[model samples]
Target: MAFTNEQIAVLEGAIASGILTVRYADRTVTYQSLKEMRITLRQMRGEMAAQVPGRPRARRTIRLYQSGSGNV
Candidate 1:
């Protein structure tokens, strides 16, 4: 499911407030713990970025180069 900025804001607020129970627009969710909430928040942010645009995509790259020693 796509997440809205409002939802993210709500979750962030709960985390900042150090509360586990988050009351969203029309729903109230009780997290198992602060750690879980944090994890969810991260996921939410990632998902939001993926859903929206202007977010930089992560890329993994590797370059190999060899240099001659003593003109060998």
Candidate 2:
């Protein structure tokens, strides 16, 4: 479904205000992160790229090192 200009304005407003929440057709969407918001915006604008499945999500790796390792 295509979004109207008013809806676009609301989305833009939410982005600008850093709210990241939108109410659409009696449904509320609280974006998890900026990435999710952008994806939703793209979809609302009829962009197919964001609609594709298997889109790799950003991943962060952390190193866990033990000092003076002991079998405990």
Candidate 3:
């Protein structure tokens, strides 16, 4: 699920307090580990970046260049 900035803040707070449980309004989430929480935070940040206005999303690119010599 995509998390909002508020949700991300809550997660960060929990991590800062060394807590595994995060509360958001009426819902509460208990994470399995710090690794899980960190992963969630990273994902949330990435999502936030993707939602920025006029920002370019990651794209695939290809470039053709000459190698050493034509001999193989």
Clashes of each: 0, 0, 0
TM-score of each: 0.72, 0.51, 0.73
Taking all chains together, the TM-score of candidate 3 against the true structure is: 0.73
Task: Write down the lDDT that model 1 would get.
Answer: 0.88
lDDT of 1 by residue, 9-55 (tens): 99999889998899887889999999999999899988887876777
Error of 1 at 26 (Å): 1.7
lDDT of every model, 2 decimals:
0.88, 0.72, 0.92
lDDT for predicted candidate 2 compared with the true structure:
0.72
Name the regions of candidate 3 deviating beyond 4 angstroms: 59-72
| lDDT by residue for model 3 (1-72), tens | 667889989899999999999999899889999999999899999999988999999898999999899898
* lDDT of candidate 2 over 15-55, digit per residue (tens): 88889788866888888987888777766765333355787
Q: Could you tell which candidate, 2 or 3, scores higher by TM-score?
A: 3
